[model samples]
Structures are given as C-alpha cells and as structure tokens.
Target: GDRVLATAILDRVLHHAITINIRGHSYRLKEKLKAGLVRLEETATTT
Candidate 1:
C-alpha cells in the first residue's frame, strides 16, 4: 500500500514537471532534496 501510493505520487509529480516544466523551481528543488535525504536515511538505517 505504501509503495503503491508513493509510486503514484512520484509519477504524478514527474508528469506535472514534464508537462509544466517545473525546472529551476525552488519549491520543487527543496522537495526533491528532502525526499533524497529521507531515502538516504532509510537506507542507512536499514543497513
């Protein structure tokens, strides 16, 4: 359930970015960085 929801949200955001060209957007950049950090933390904790 969680993976499916995350995948859906990621896909939607990617589609929106491609269609609306959300490059150089501070909000999106911050969000991406935050998500990356979260993934890194998760991986670190797992290993």
Candidate 2:
C-alpha cells in the first residue's frame, strides 16, 4: 500500500475509535506452551 493512502485510510478509520496496545505473545503461542509443544529458551535449556 502507498504510505499516503494508508495514512489517510488509517486516519479515517481511527477518527472515532479507541485503540489498545496489547503486549506479549499471542494466544496461539500460549496454548502451544501449555500443551508442552512450545518452550522458551530458558525452559528448553533447563529440560
């Protein structure tokens, strides 16, 4: 997308909207972690 057009579209859509900034990993990764399929570097090192 053109930067100018993208900015215009974003400006229009967000004119009356409230935005939230979410932090950290996504739910899918969390699920994988809980299921013992995904591990953080520290966890993998320990095990």
Candidate 3:
C-alpha cells in the first residue's frame, strides 16, 4: 500500500535521474570578467 506507492515513485524518479559532474570556472565570475567587474589576475592569485 504505502510502501508500494513510495517504491513506485522512487523507481520513476531514479529512472529519469541523470548524474552530472561539473568542473569549470564559475559562470558568475566569467560574466563579471566579461563585464569588467572582475580581474583575471585576482582570480588567478585567489585560487
């Protein structure tokens, strides 16, 4: 009953789930750099 319904919902969610692994610069920082709000040298030294 409840357990069966929960299992069905979880199964459907897992079926549509896709794992993502992201590795890159921050999009916000990139935008800032493009807008001249952030400096390339500052990011290089901070990280």
Top-TM-score candidate index: 2
Candidates' C-alpha lDDT: 0.64, 0.81, 0.87
Assess the local accuracy of residue 18 in candidate 2 as a C-alpha lDDT between 0 and 100.
100
Clashes per model (N, Cα, C within 3 A): 0, 0, 0
Best candidate according to lDDT? 3
Candidate 1 matches the true fold with a TM-score of 0.34
Locate the minimum summed-lDDT window of 10 residues in model 1: 38-47
Give each model a TM-score. 0.34, 0.58, 0.45
Q: Which 10-residue window of candidate 3 scores lowest in summed lDDT?
A: 16-25
Output the worst ten-in-a-row residue range by lDDT, candidate 2: 38-47
Residues 4-29, model 2: lDDT tens digits: 99999999999999999997777877
lDDT of 3 by residue, 19-47 (tens): 67777678998999999998998998775
Q: Candidate 1, residue 16: CA error in Å? A: 4.1
